[model samples]
Target: MKKSPRRTFIRDTAIAATGFFIVPRHTLGRGFVAPSDKLNIAGIGVGGKAEVNLPFAWNNGSDNIAALCDVDDRMAVKARARWPKAPYYKDYRVLLEKEQKNIDAVIITTPDHMHAVQALAAMQLGKHVYLEKPLTHDIYEARTLTKAAEKYRVVTQMGNQGSSGDDTRLVETWIQSGVIGEVKKVHVWTNRPTWPQGVPVPKGSFNVPAELDWDLWLGTAPQRDYNPAFLPAIWRGWSDYGTGSLGDMGCHFIDVPYRALKLGYPVSVECNVGSVYTGFFQEAIYYESYPPSSITYIQFPARGEMPPVEMIWYDGGMKPPRPAELQPEEQMGELDGGIIFEGSTGKLMAGLFGRKPTLLPLSKMASATLPKSAFEFVENGSDGHQQQWVKACKKGYGAYTSSSFDKSG
Candidate 1:
């Protein structure tokens, strides 16, 4: 009888586990769970979103949580309490070196600036990586990581759960199958910067908190005295530490349209940021941070059979003009954000994550030519995205993932 690779590998792990070489539960504690099929995983940046992301990726203990690392002990409290047996460290470099033998994959939920460095470091050691969206802090780093993922021949996934959803694939089918003929323009908008921006860094005598490692938390970013202004979740508004609102939610917002249209690199891009007035004629010195609002235009060159495409991004509560085809009572998009693709025959609108996709005019759905999909495109939500990566990791390198560097980059 032929054995599937997954089952064969699990059998081997079970054999290895039952060997004379055994581990003491006392060392790893009662939390030590040795599931033969489980991948030994590490959690980097186990705070903020990582707090939530870890569970989704861990998938309720389907995978073993072997190690945990974070710069802030205060922020790490909940995670540490949850996985006490998983050794904790304040420094990723240290955790990588010490736990290198224990973990098979690394989940990176660090801030934008640290993403490239942490992910690159882990991948260099041949560990599979699950990194958050936007991929890296800059274009160069993003390109570098993309090449590294291929060169190292390791399984990788980007944390854009919307890409894994059924709505995303459905949108892809609708566009690819010509339901919306030749999209030439797209408008994406978000209501981000829910954190403060457009203001200069605050002034005060701030003390670095005892539970946090200020220097490590600011990895690759320029050094400054740690301040309360950037703590917990406010870093998204800062230019040095975070990617601002665009990087905060743009990846999720653009994933559907970009993939469906095959919109490659932009030919030309331009952007303008709104200014903040500091009373009188003076404007706030916010060059160090993104503005409260921004509008960007990206023009992509035509692909083989596709036409040149123009995509506009609006954030900070800005939105495009309401389509005339729709009645006044019809909703344009969710309060969070939405996207509209202007095609030759009609327009397609969807929520930020491609949810509730619809044809314009409310009446168009009646006559819209729905495409026949080869397979059902019904995947959606973050839980499925995390499990997708976990299962892919178990399947080894070259396994499929929805938003690997190839797609997300």
Candidate 2:
């Protein structure tokens, strides 16, 4: 008969992120009682990025850490120590099977390759999921998870915290409001590959680490011998195991233009990669890993009043040419990466996650009439993203999330 306290927090949280409210199911249809006021979340990969994600998802103990899962116990130390009582499992399937009734939701921060399987397994059990970004390994997996989330009618959100940021919605509003004119081109670049990339696979027969289940860690991916080089968050460059820098950061950098402009799918795409030559004119060919850098060109078709948008992605330190409109004192994006939008009237640019958005040439703002961001909800750090999902799950399905499976897919 009344709004749940969790639902009220979710509404206020949504107002911070999108200046909107998450209407509880009771208001729209039959009342739906959530699993609990405090969601019981299980982490599939409780290491690497999970170290940061788990705590944010926990949200100051408002939620319960019902269970934990990770192939490498070494990677699970902090999580296990934090929630010493939550059941831990090295295999996700076993975790799901054993703790299905206990966990109301799952936070899957596993690598890209394992996201689809781990997410679907839990969603099939009707558990809400907060999956890490680059939603799935590829298009097929993305589509599968997208369709499954809709079919199962579960709460879903990707790990792109920027989506809940004021800048994200600001960029969306600015572009959609035509302040940047009709965006015809977008350039996104990231300085990733901080790990071993463009190098030959490590060659050696090392005993599998006692802390890791080599076979379990390689779930759904091609079986391979375990090597220290592939982990500790260094798997992004491997073609077999990771999606390179693009996957590592594309979802964050490119997501702005894609959402702002509604670029559904690319019509055509081409890519070129930098070469690593062992000697002059002698290229060191390595097929197992992504090249040191790459340039990708994707062409998207026009929709409604919008024209065809040309999106270019550069990684491994490559970046688009500096816009002449930018003054000498100004910088394009931050050291990590940035995104630039080219429209008919002027250009719009922002650093990673579309933060610190600026119109080209510092002088433009004086004459330009900018629309108000209209966003009342603002989140600090990356807590808003996961908390949005937690609240959405508490409110039941149909609650709003910026990067749901359908949008991310």
lDDT of each: 0.80, 0.82
Q: Candidate 2's residue-wise lDDT over 149-189, tens digit each?
A: 88767889999888878888788889999997899999999
Residue range 166-218, candidate 1, lDDT tens digits = 77777888988778789999999998979998888888878888888787777
Off by over 4 Å in 1: 1-36, 367-369, 372-381
Distance (Å) between predicted and true CA of 289, model 2? 0.5
Deviation (Å) of 291 in candidate 1 = 1.2
Q: How well does model 1 score by local distance difference test?
A: 0.80
Give candidate 1's error at residue 194 in angstroms: 0.7
